[model samples]
Target: MSGFASWIGGALGWTLGGPIGAAIGFAIGAAVDKATSKGLLLEPPKRGSQQRRKRVDPVYEKRRRRKTVREKQAQTKSGDFEVSLLVLSAIVMKVDGEVSESEKDFVRNYFTKMYGKQRANHAFKLFNGLLKKEDISTRQICQQIQMYMDHSSRLQLLHYLFGVTKADGHVDESEVDLIEKIAGYLYINDRDFQSIKAMFYNPVDSAYKILEIDKSATNNEIKKAYRKMAKKFHPDKLEHLGEEHMKGANEKFQKVQKAYEQLQKERGF
Candidate 1:
């Protein structure tokens, strides 16, 4: 089968059951199909007789096609993820009653830096169009994301959302509330939510929140949580998500380390 067909089949296999999932999936599929059709996805027909084709290495051909299919699948998933980011970002930006141009530019620049000018422009246009609609639900978007993405990846996404809110130098209380709601809907545990929250928000409990532990927790427990969080946010762990994603993950991971150091200094560990 063609790469396009393979990607569509895989998308259909995902447990995207609700109206929100269906709408987002259809939009992403259409966008991916349009963007990829002129390139690697369109396979040319076999030009010769069966006997002539038999001379070719069957194993190599099979492996090559499989690799192509995997690439197409990854691309499709990445496209879908960016689209979802924009949708949820719109909601987050408007949580304080208005979406500022500065906030819009931050997202636009993010897309451009990550995806080239053409795709960025296309995505920004799609994002703007979607932003006009007033019916998007934070719960539905979170549910859809939670179904497909692993816990670590969701944490990384939350990190990026926090980054967006901080682009203006301070996060609005309303934005923080909406993000907490998104975290709940996405099934993210309270500890993980507060952990990521501390990375952006200034709080008296910064060290504990960063380690995802309470002040009453023993030193041993705090150390263990720090180690576990380090592994979870390591840049290597997010390599499959792409270079830009890895960069963002690394930034968060560094914050994790910084928090640990702060605790060590305070406790004289």
Candidate 2:
């Protein structure tokens, strides 16, 4: 623990441990000294039957509430998308026996654009660290993602993995197998997996795959699928991920929109 953390633990009577502690410490900021002083200024509890619980400071309580809100906001701002991307990207790169230089360069540039050059290098180091591990569990990572991420987000995650595997213009069979296993762990439907897979590896019926619909589907069905996909891949949903991520989301959204337009034009609907 840093001096600030030590002082905070001692002063607030809080066991600084997890997310809550981090939030409170960040919220206290420069006001930590004042909060500590308030703690010190409290009257000591009397002995025996007269002993009472220490009075809670209203100001501190107010700050605590505010801290919770700030924590929620902070979580939203933190790059969940970016971190998840890196983790899965490592898996995609290493699935085929060895990580290729082209794949590494692709990931490095991707991270650099999302984060800065310094942070990108740090991310690459973390990627290398994961690769060094003897038993990296893809199932566990996918489980975590499936628990935290929405269905559409997971679909987008699969889409991104496909992008990484295809970065060198050829997707390895091992990479495809790994991605399919990841999709299974993520609880994604086979149809959904094939749908996203079609976009990158096979463009024969990409419009239907992009919209996640079928030729036998009615016009209303197509429209509904388009609306749902549009909402799912909307750039606005990625706004919390920063402008760079939003740009990527926008590109995905455009693909969905274009697919919808193509269907409409072809079907005269």
The Cα error of candidate 2 at residue 37, in Å, is: 26
TM-score of 2: 0.68
In model 2, state the lDDT of residue 225.
Answer: 95
Worst 10 residues of 2 by lDDT: 13-22
lDDT of 1 by residue, 37-80 (tens): 53423332445646643466889999987676555444435545
User: What is the alpha-carbon lDDT for the whole of candidate 1?
Assistant: 0.71
Writing each residue's lDDT as its tens digit, candidate 2 over 78-141 gives 2455556766787678877887788888889987887788667655665665555545568776
Please, what is the TM-score per model? 0.73, 0.68
Stretches of candidate 1 above 4 Å error?
Answer: 1-76
- Alpha carbon lDDT of each predicted model: 0.71, 0.68
Specify the poorest-scoring 10-residue window by lDDT in model 1. 8-17
Model 1 RMSD in Å is 9.8
